[model samples]
Target: MSASPAPKSYAPWLLMLPALVMVVVFFGIPMAYMLRMSFNLHVDEKFYVPGFTFEHYAQLFANPLFTAAIWTTIKLAFAAALATVVIGYCFALIAWLKPPRWRFLLVGLALCPLLISEVAIIFGWWMFFPKNGLLSYALVSSGLITSKFSLMYTEFAAFVGLIYITLPYCFFIMLSVFDGIDKRTLEASADLGAGPFQTFVEVLLPLSRAGLAVAFSQAFIWAIGTYATPSALGPDTLWTVGYLIQDQMLNKHNWPMASAFSMILVAGVAVVMAVTRSFMAKRQAVHV
Candidate 1:
């Protein structure tokens, strides 16, 4: 024979078959189970009853508490994400402009937080905010205050925690984006008599708009899903969708209700990501 038979084009798909199976087994099966459970009936004594009903979805809107929690979660997440992106952008820009040694130092500091566990981070913040904590002691030692004061169990404390945890991810993302940009453009802008602020607004901002969108979406998703830090640090009034799901599953033993809430949370996040990506794509198209 002049040549052996050629291999099939579908060989690559055969190689991918195990990964596809794993994805369906791990993700798809659980998702289907949760979806089916969401419509099941729930009894006070039992975890769930095997009857389909739309009562849970109806109750989601009917209950003012759940509605309030949804709004509160969205509000805090957006605010925290916006703050994180702004701070991260500035941090990344400074790091980008630094010399090589300083650049590495700044990057090392940014990465330090990621090595620590979220629980430990929250506990550290918890200890720092109470009346008898490090912050109060520092203020008193510095003669800034006559007595110890507490920021514990406040929305501000919770917001700070949210930002602290999400900052590293945002910073690294922006840093990578900045690294891809040519250094010559900034120098050229300065040569053209553009002020620092003007250069940032006209050149840097336009170049990094897509990265900003990505970082915001990432931070927002993280903030919304994190319940432990906020609940532990914040006031009792702060109830998020995450807290609701936890309460339903563990405290209330209402699996159906928890499943319903979980479904809604998943749907909400999916919709947000879809909208954000679509809007950014349209903006990019317009710019081009």
Candidate 2:
């Protein structure tokens, strides 16, 4: 016909060029630099030699503080992810079951914490948790306790802040999954004399397992990498890997060690993501 329009192959590649450039410039270069730097040796207070060595990585495991930080990071992330999943599931289920008109309000309320910046949220909680803040004032004023008591600088406060920050992600993820589920299934289960708990355990939970895995993984990764909220709210002893990374890079001026810690964090997150993907794939296969 008219030379068959000469094919459109180059157009797609041209369209993708910008994205490729951005990725290389933003991600690939930095990642390569970090990996290279991780192999370097720290010479002194302000200098790191460019020679390749595994000393940084070796020190990461050999140092008791670093190992403890790894354990603490895992423990906090796991606990926060678990709590977020359970609470978010309940909240999403309630919102999903409500009338369409009420759903908007429920989602809005759930989004309130997310709408605020993390720093602002932390500050708000900081004020509310201190001895002179509203919580203590109210308890003392209402005769609930003899004197004002502070909840600040406690593991509980850190956990609360972590859960608050991550809950919205878990909620939206489960909410989307819940939207795809048919309410008629619940009705059918009820018709078959299944109670609410039975329907949830048997039908709802199984159906949303993939979303749960994804949400939990995301929350865990976030918690693991977060340093500010935990550091501000938790006691000094509650050191996390993220805090340690910052400490190594900024306070100690140890670039190689910082890079090594960052690489380890990245590896841990990657492993979590890989496991989640595998679990989700298996779940999908079973359903199929």
Candidate 3:
């Protein structure tokens, strides 16, 4: 006959205290520092000066190299994100519809790329795409080509690397989304004479809109910030904002410029996330 304990007003905040502290300490402080630093001056090859100036931010558009880098990053990220989503959707759907005995194996394979560091993964692809590497050897052994073929230092190579890294994120996200879907709805679609592709377009895509949007946004963000894989796998013409940021900070020893580029990157990521949330909300409303 005892009354249930009343819910504490501060309980939810108490549970979130650690995460709030982490966000403030780690993300908030660094962003603030970077924002302040972006306005500082860089004088005579010195790391930075404490004086305020708008030159760093202004050069973002005035400088042709920076403009090209920004555009290249956008194009590369868009292509990579689209490719990752399509491939991940197909793979995840196949895995989802497979027998339970095979699901574990497919999931394990999807997770294999994530277990390795990006640097290690890039190195493996580096070897594979080179003239004397396994891919060339296989092609030669199969008599497909008389001479060795090299894909290294190509946009295709860079695109492949970008897709490889982002695919797992998309796969897992879509898989979880698929898991929450009602199987009977899919069966109903089939019973109503909808073909596989028709059902995918009408039912699967609509049901998984939220997850697809999130996965695409995440992939786009990651692809835009890609620094090493493109530098390693793609041609010198392929320049990204990340490459410029590193060059400005370390090579040019220009902290202000680096911070300015970083602010732009952060802004782009924020916009993508906002769009994703909005898109998801709209989708939810429509479905409801």
What does each candidate score in C-alpha RMSD?
3.2, 3.0, 3.0
lDDT at position 276, candidate 2: 96
Which candidate has the top score in lDDT? 3
Candidate 3 matches the true fold with a TM-score of: 0.95
Report the error of model 2 at residue 248, Å.
1.2
lDDT of 3 by residue, 1-288 (tens): 997766797799889999999999999999999999999999999999999999998999999999999999999999999999999988998899999978999999999999999999999997899999999999999999999989999999999999999999999999999999998898999999999889989998888888989999989999998899998899988889988998998999999999999999999999999999999889888878
lDDT measured at residue 140 in model 3 versus the true structure, 0 to 100? 98
Q: Which tens-of-lDDT digit does each residue in 1-288 have in candidate 1?
A: 596656887788889999999999998899899999999998766899999999999989999999999899989999999999999999999999999999999999998779999899988997899999999999999999999999999999999999998999999999999999999999999999999999999999988888888899889989998989889999999998889999998988899889998888788779879977997888879978
Give the per-residue lDDT of model 2 (tens digit) for 23-112: 999988998899999999888686578799998899888989889999998999999999999999999999999998899999999999
lDDT order, best first, reads 3, 1, 2
What pairs collide in candidate 3? none
Model 3 weakest 10-residue run by lDDT: 3-12
State the displacement of the C-alpha of residue 244, model 2, in Å, after optimal TM-score superposition: 1.1
By summed lDDT, the worst window of 10 consecutive residues in model 2 runs over 1-10
Assess each prediction's global lDDT (C-alpha) against the native.
Answer: 0.92, 0.91, 0.94
Give the runs in model 1 whose Cα sits over 4 Å from its true position. 1-22
